[model samples]
Target: MPKVSKHLNAANLIDQVCKCLDEIPDHRPNHCPNGIPFPNFAKSAFAMMHQKYDSLLTFDSDRADPVILHNLATMYHVQDQKVPCDTRMREVLDPIEPAQFRKPFKKLFSLIQRNKLLKAFEYQCGDLKDWYLMPVDGTGLFYSGKCRCQECCVKNKGKPNEAYYHNLLGGCIVHPDQKVVMPFAPEAIVQQDGDNKNDCEQNAIKRYLAHVKREHPHLKLVILLDGLFADNPTIELIKSYGWHFIIVAKDGNHKSLIEAMDALCDQEQLSYHKIIDEEQGTRHWFRFANDVPLNASKLTQNVNVLDYVETDSEGKRHTWCWVTDIELTKDTVEAVMRGGRCRWHIENQTFNTLKNQGYSLEHNYGHGKQHLATNLAYLTFLAFMVDQIQEMASPEFKKALKERARGVRTYLWKVITRVFLSWMLEGWDELFDALIYGIKPGRVQINTS
Candidate 1:
């Protein structure tokens, strides 16, 4: 008998996810040719995503077996698999409503909040306490030559050209100390008829505002962005939504604003800083504008502007600027600076983690006409969230990480991949156990009986 330990239980992560997944609508298509139920495929695809696979179907067929649900349930360590066939899974996903996949984000967030994970990341503005910072950005996902659907936002050139795709603004509350970026509602950037030649990031931000308002109602939001989003209309819309704005104010884009800030700087009342970070081997020069006029367009809202220049040990200077609604005072300046600079957390925590850290976010999952793209994208993010939780909160897994550096720990993934081919334990718990304490050499525990 192969003694398998139940150490790698990623339970809290799964519990939070289940809170969201339970809300997914169970609408089985009556026209599924094979009469296969939809929930089985849904569960299986979700399991494949949790395992960080590029294609759920491929992972089902090639990795474990062609029986989707059985393989998935087994991988999850759940017994009694009612696995569906790959063709049936695809058919079920094709006709499913895209909105069904979204039912979970709100619920999942509620779970996280209830669990007090949200409060773990907190900062202050003036007298304001427990304020959270959310940064918003967009990214493009898929491109294909031969497949284009009504949902396809862009198409490649030539007859069999692949279609181009886009996903709209992903807003998340991020902190520099945190490993995970808690995701909020995302707006999809789709093609519109003659409204604008091409829908843009700012437009997507407009779309995101209502949903953010609906879901978060009273939640304080400080929307951070790049310079392209620092326009008068965008600022006005953000004000209308009753949210604060913290956007990049680049000299190239906000020339008038920069000029105004510079004029204010000459008056000597504005805030400024000159500091050297010996540890980082860099020096910084920073200036800020408090309650400055944004543009000549007569916008009534007030914004705080921050500017910074960095000089490396090699004598290279880099400059950046931003505008925000967060109050600027003697004490809150550093917190706001940290929040402003933490915008890179989305890149490091969300995008790069998905790409390089085993989530296979850019991999070509099933490109169904409707829900597949968004559904898979959500799953990839969910997987990253789970892994992050395990790394941070799971003492067992963290010990595994501590035993080896990140590179070596990643190399161990190859070992799991090989083990997955030859045999199956109960689930990730068993896999972790076997790795930490090797299974008996000749014992086979895959339940071949």
Candidate 2:
């Protein structure tokens, strides 16, 4: 069978993740005793996400089952007999900063890199095979009026509780050719330092960029963002980190940028190129101008503008413009435009999958007084990161994922949901085997009481 690294099998990868959870410093008071191990709460929360359980109540309900307890021990390294209940999970996980979960994302990434699954995300840039296409975007997790927290971003200025919401800045390594996008740790967007000023996506991007850079200093990336991030400060911040960016520059949002492009076109400085297919009845047009000022105010800092238009077989023309620091040529414009357009994958593939698929990211799992909502979001993404890596690297997992009418990812989780809730797994392999080959993976214990 085709394979990834011997260690990339989910069993070992999960062990590493469990270890990372174990290292999350317990925030409970030093004098506290007889409480559940902090890692058990973390692992139990992760298990709930991994199994696509409906809520903390659903996962907590089965904590007493010997089968559920055994599966937690075998699969998630929860040695504690006590799994944290719904309220307990949130209360314990609340004060813990969301950044603590980032190690698991990095751990999974290192393993994926070692296993060479990340090469799929790399695209050729001149003689270098180093550029990983990463798209950064913000998304709404959920909103609540009555369930407000200190970290919730209030949308309206009138009533403090009128429109409380939670948003996250999510970024991931992506390629146009792949369905699976490798996610980095996401940044939560909320009120900062208990301030009344609502945090915006722009501020979150600053924190997101700084944190990702600190975590992965050597990794080369081409960051993609929407029109909101196509600004002087954000671009300058990206450059300070020695990274490249392709940010969408819309006509209304960046009128100065469009004016600059128009001037370049009038001066005949903009290079134009096109690729057409008679067989498919499609046309792709590209225009690029280098060293254009970002805006009237920021004349000193310049960016490259690439305009793209595509005419489909149905004769519908779609167009877009992007500002980037990557040196643009007619030859490189199409590649850069494709990468720029990948910002949508942050919406369609990543966020949409998390919401529509079994991940249940927007579900108000439990919003605590502090970081409960944010920490749960990280665990959901962490589970998603591990699941995506397995989907790509594990032959066994791939087989299980494609079984019967369950080829859809949402369906696989359904199988896992049933297994996790009902099946008495002897080991992790039995679950995989049962999903793939339909053997009796486990049996429910007979009622003797």
| TM-score against truth, every candidate | 0.83, 0.94
The lDDT for every candidate, in the order shown, is 0.64, 0.83
- Return the TM-score for candidate 2, rounded to 2 decimals: 0.94
Prediction 1 global C-alpha lDDT: 0.64
Model number with the top TM-score: 2
- Displacement of residue 277 (Cα, Å) in model 1 is 3.5
How many steric clashes between backbone atoms does each model show? 7, 0
Residue-wise C-alpha lDDT for candidate 1, range 301-352, written one tens digit per residue: 5678887787999989987777888777656666677778778877777777
Which portions of model 2 miss their true places by more than 4 Å?
A: 1-3, 30-34, 193-199, 298-300, 440-446
RMSD of each: 5.1, 2.4
Model 2 lDDT tens row, 1-449: 22456477778878999999999987788825776777998998998888877678877778898879988888888876778778878889899988898999999888887777877788665543678888999889988767888889876657654788888989999988888889999889887723343237888888899988998898888999988878778888989988898888888888878988888789888888999989999999999888888888935589888898999999999998888888888668878877888889999999998998888999989999989999999999998888888777777777787773357877777877677666667666878887777754356566898
Task: Give me the displacement of residue 443 in model 1, in angstroms.
Answer: 6.8
